[model samples]
Target: MRLALAQLNPVVGDLRGNAERILAAARSASAEGATLLLTPELSLWGYPPRDLLLQPARLALQSAVLDGLVEQLDGLCSLLVGVALPCDDDRAPGLYNGIALVDQGGWRGVARKQLLPSYDVFDERRYFRPGDGPCLLTLEEGERLGLTICEDLWVEDALQRERLAGPDPIAALVEAKPDLLINLAASPFDPSKPALRRQLAGQAARRLNCPVVYLNQVGGNDELVFDGSSLVVAPDGSTLLELPACREAVQVWDSSGPQQATAPLSQTPCREELLLRALVLGVRDYAGKCGFQRALLGLSGGIDSALVAVIAAAALGPENISALLMPSPWSSSGSINDATALANRLNIKTHTLPIQGLMQGFDTSLTPALGQQPQGVTAENLQSRIRGTLLMAVANQQGQLLLTTGNKSELAVGYCTLYGDMNGGLAVIGDLYKTSVFALCDWIDSPEARNCREDLGLPQQGELVGEAIRRKPPSAELRPDQKDSDSLPDYSELDPLLKGLIQERTTPQALVAAGHDIPLVERVQRLLQRAEFKRRQAAPLLKVSPQAFGSGWRLPIAAGGLCSAGPD
Candidate 1:
């Protein structure tokens, strides 16, 4: 059987657009002589529609669109498209995330999602009811195939800390022992997941002794970027076919013969390459979806702005990426040159607007009766606020989206300014740490840049070495001789402390007892809890970790009993 995996990107709630794309893929697959085409789970409505699943009107609209799809495509090929199905079961109108097999003639069979994953990014329990069984559907090759949606096969492990009904779907399906196993899914992107998905499927197929086809969705959705490295695994535990991550593709696999080696995909791009692509798509989709074109970023010579500039260039063409270098007296000459060098490397336009005059103007304007009693860091902060104001003015004039570059580690310790550096339409790497940011930049400048696909073009930071900047002490340079280390512990020390506190959910006293400095731990914990108010108002963050500081990790801002609380 020749199968086609429709690894495409879908826009959530764009019913017409999603349906049109799926129909187009079906026609394309037919041209390739593929008998059956499997699309990602929830391909019609887009995965994890969240609360949109609640409205009865919306589900009705989705069903109407599905009917239209069946009405339109009758002869091209068969499509196994995923969507939600409504039940009149009186036991609470159950909605199942299921797949509909529609041939040229009409609807074939509907297979509901048996496993409702309710962990991490998923809240299936809040919305969907679990499906009871699987389906053996007819394929053009005269084969009865077993069908399972994403979470169905991922049921080997307990969905929660608690256990549930039935054995793993894949194991149970092997007993029914259809000729082939077709799994539709919308597995999201994690940097480590592409390889893990390939390896997991290879092992599963080798154990099952049957060809396993996995289909995954690709594209950016709000806070998530789905890499569509969809795969086909042979029964002998080998990857027969693979598609590039974050790209839309229709991967074809023939299930009859022993797999032959074709051109292997380029090695996973360096960390910089991964970050660059992720950010580009992140910015592009965020702006494009929210209905904007141009993006404006404040370009300080510092690494954060430089990285955001690179990301903006890749996202909205160089012409669309505009930068304003608002340097204050504290800003160094090297910083200006670095920003200029970065703009040149990216081929984007740059504007140098000195903020010294602006800073003085603000200082003079505020000198009515405000005395300088506690004249320490607050005095230096005025310069940052002035720069931020200048950047906002330029952004407003050009009608561009402002991009803020403050990172996760800094934000964790209240190291950033609220109305100052925290202004932007999106916080690109707000969830990333300082160390990972530099590592990603190194990947971009390495020899591997030559191997990246020409279509998805990356940002080049030029022959202007990435390491010097990488190693140069991380500093805001807001004040003369100011460095990040002056106020906070080294990130080598702080990030691990943060991981222990946030990821491990450790308490302050417990953390100090476990090798953290008592004073530092107490200060860090207080700052973390106090900063909840700032984080609550911050822009949505891109989630790369199991836990993030934004909506993914919500804690109380004023509640005293946050530790091991019942309902955060």
Candidate 2:
């Protein structure tokens, strides 16, 4: 049997549009002489449709959409479409995250997801009830197929220790001894996930002693980005085919074919390149899906905004991106010139809106209300607000999506200004640490990034970010002679500390014992906790790392459990 894998991008809650996407892929697959078509998890409503699954109107529309799919697939081919199945029992969760097989005859539920992950960004338990056991579908030719959803195939106790209590779906399915196993997944992207998924699939294929097909969703939805590296693993645990990462693709696999040697996984791009592609895809999908053709950002000539500009130009065409240089009284000439140079290199439009006048006006107006002029951090924040207001005005006037330019390190320590520099529809690099920002910029300017830049439609020639911007000392330029180092520790030192605290969940003493200064660790810890309020109000940021400040990093702003010195 020839099976077509539809690694597609779906818009959440757009039942009509998502159904149309599936139908289009099915027609193409049918033309390619494929007998069966497989789609990712929840392709009809998009993955993690969240509360949309609970809406009465959406529940009512589900049946109509399924009927439409059946009509489209009639006489063309058999399609396994991921959809939400409403339960008849009122005591149940009211729905099952399930797959329905639609053939020329009719459609019916074939399988439902058994393992509902509640950890991290996933809240599946809130919407879906677990399936009882393995579901086997028999074709007209007497070919038996075993079906599983995203988490069903992930039964590795060592890898998923928290989920060990759940019944092993793969083991249960293996007992049925079907000819083939197919998994529909909407797994989100993490740098380490692709390799981990490959290991899991190989293990499953070996255990079942049958060919395994894994179909994954591709696209960015809000903060999550899904990399669709769909694949077909032979019965001997050899990979016959591997789809492209961070892209939408379709490929056909023959179940009768001999088991081929596994392809080398070394061909996967290095960590930096993979991350760049993910971010670019995230920005593109978020902007396009949210209905923004154009994007704009405040260009400070510093590394953060420069990197965001490059990403924006690559995501939306350079012509579609605009940069506003809102220099304040303290802004340096070199900073302004550097910003202009970077914009010129990227071929993006730029407008100068010096904020010195706005700063003075604000000082005069607020003198009476404050009984004195705003100074120190307040004064510095006022400058950021002025620049932010101008960026917003330009973005609003031109109907462009504004991109925020803050990084993880600053955000962790509360170094960013809320509603001021934090104003944006999307935080493009909020998941990257300040040190990572520098490293990425360095790589972008180097020879290694040529192919990636060209592939992404960025300037492939010469240095795109340039040496001047990359070499300049990091500064916000909100005040004269100001540097990030004035208030915060060097990023090289701070980034590792933040990683230990945020990602590793290490305590103060533990960090100190690992060679960090006690006072500095405690101070940084306090800043991170105090800054939760600011992060709470910040724009939705693209998540690239294992632990990002958005959705996954759940912490209460008012809560207090500050680490203190111990007997050590």
Q: Which candidate achieves the best TM-score against the true structure? A: 2
Candidate 1 residue pairs in backbone clash:
74-104, 272-440
Error of 2 at 260 (Å): 0.8
Which clashing pairs does model 2 show? none
Score candidate 1 by TM-score against the native. Answer: 0.91
In model 2, the runs with Cα more than 4 Å from the true position are: 160-164, 261-266, 565-568
User: Model 1: per-residue lDDT, tens digit, 402-521?
Assistant: 888898888887788877888777888887887777776666667666455244555432443355555567788877888989988888888877877776777766776677777778
lDDT of 2 by residue, 1-568 (tens): 9899999999999999998888888888889888999999999989879999889899899889888887777667689999998888886578999999988677889998898988778889889999998888889999999999999888886654345358888899777898999999999987888877877888899999998899999999999999898888888877888888899887777788767844464377777787888899999999999999999999988999999999999888899999998887788999999999999999999989877788889999999999999988999999888878888888898899999999999899999998799999999999999888888888988899999999999988899888888888898877779899999999888999999999888877888888888888888899999999999999999988888998888999998778773435
Cα lDDT of model 1 overall?
A: 0.74
Segments in model 1 whose C-alpha atoms lie over 4 Å from true places:
90-93, 156-167, 259-272, 453-455, 458-468, 504-515, 561-568
Q: Tell me how many residue pairs clash in candidate 1.
A: 2
Clashes of each: 2, 0
* C-alpha RMSD by candidate, in order: 3.5, 1.7
